[model samples]
Target: MINNFIKTCAQSKLSSIYEELLDTSKQALAVNNGNIAKWESAIDELKKHNKGGVNYQPPYININTSNSDTKLIQQSLKKLTPWRKGPYQIGDLQLDSEWRGDMKWDRLKNHIQPLKEKTVLDVGSGNGYFTYLMALSGAQIALGIEPFLLFNYQFMSIHTLINNPPNAFVLPLKLEQMPKEAVFDTVFSMGVLYHQKDHLLHLQQLKTLLVDDGELVLETLIIDKKHGKQIIPKDRYARMRNVWCLPSTDTIHTWLKKVGFKNIKLLDITKTTPQEQRATHWIGNNTQSIKDFLDPNNDKLTVEGLPAPLRAIFTCQK
Candidate 1:
């Protein structure tokens, strides 16, 4: 299984580096159960050859002895619920509106019942809004893993209120950095997988974190239609230059099946307005030119004039 997984990864020309890391990970898993000291030695050797960004660090939190300051911070977070925006809010950072509305609390509750007495993992849990919601919904324990430093602190403080709140621990690490022993009954990832350069590796890591028959929820952007020759958004890739892979529905479905996810269901709930009105929101003299291509009645937006726009929400059993 490991060999086949590696081969599949290698087949994607853009993901060869990740494939090598996956191969090394299999070796680490083999020795991980044998000798602790030997495993550390092997890991050190692998680090020396870490040409790819595949090597992941362990997740951890920072602590200070200032009790009064920490308490004040925690209190501030407690008073800030019923947030109107998405899971993130620090000074003035925010994601798109579609993300906030897609798989929202009302919709999410319908898909997943109250997680009473169940362990849950919120992957990419920015600012811990959903984490707190899960706790309030009676989850036995909710663990959040967010890589962003500032956002992790916000989540940590808010999560601390759970009446022994299900270990609202926030680790400043990515999904791949989590310890193999950390497993959960339900895992949620929103507005995250699309940002990864190696989407397949991200999926596999999520699978490893799940217990038998666990549940997974994911939301991502998909290609709906093709537009010939489009320019890349300069601001989109500013955070991470490698986050450029946006797969079609067919491609993503196949990848999910290949990773062993069962009973996969894809739901479409996209929003689009007519080009003329869309152009009115545009700025400057370019408005007229941009408005010419607007087609509100069009079923989908074209990507690079070759593919269609198709955003989807996915749910499956791991």
Candidate 2:
């Protein structure tokens, strides 16, 4: 799989750092994780099945296959639990994930520039759901960078089941680890900004990865203007740790401008609903999801009494 990624990158605008990307991914994937054996076992089990073609089937990152052993495939995939980003369908089996990613995709797809034959980067791509969509939308190469090894394995699981797969690939590498080369025609940073300790630096790093006049699609948690510019949560918001800041749309625009981005546009602002993020059987042991995180008295507020999750998407040029 790494070789395939290398081969593609070497022939694209990313040729300069293809080897470094491969080496970094190798090192990241080499880290000792107790669950690696189980995940690898699941992937090995999946190898016995036949491959298929992938396409968008509304809610699913659908794979076309009819003769698959649905029951066996389900069992193998269960090993990589807590599926957060997708609601993929392989054959007749529906791997319903925590997030109905298509909903997010629908909101931003038409607003952003067409991806056909473009080099795309999906930062913080969980399990490569949107990355696959980007490739299916006709990108020359859609590279997904996810630091979590399990998600990379999940991506590989899906990739393994696809006959030709698309130009989509996921690696266990962080955004900071990527070579600061302006190689990508489009870069997407979704659900990643709030996790950064320095949001400005994160935005700057994103800009540095794009080609001149390239587009950036930024999506992350945001609060209403009533929250007053931003809210730096002192503790967990909606049962999630590592969430540092929730800024207003205006504040985000300011940040983008400060970082030298041009033609910044706030595309959408939708409060997250249970329909978009809810637990499914595929999420495994932790059955609790968005519903569990909200306050019993008020759905508008989290259990901690903080404003609930509201996300905004912004597009700009580097």
For every candidate in turn, the CA RMSD to the true structure comes to 15.1, 0.8
Model 1 lDDT on a 0 to 1 scale: 0.49
For each candidate in turn, the TM-score is 0.54, 0.99
The residue-by-residue lDDT of candidate 1 on 204-248, one tens digit each, is 888887777777777665554342222233343312344456666
| Lowest lDDT block of 10, candidate 2 | 1-10
Cα RMSD of predicted structure 2: 0.8
* Off by more than 4 A, model 1: 1-103, 157-167, 225-242, 272-310
Off by over 4 Å in 2: none
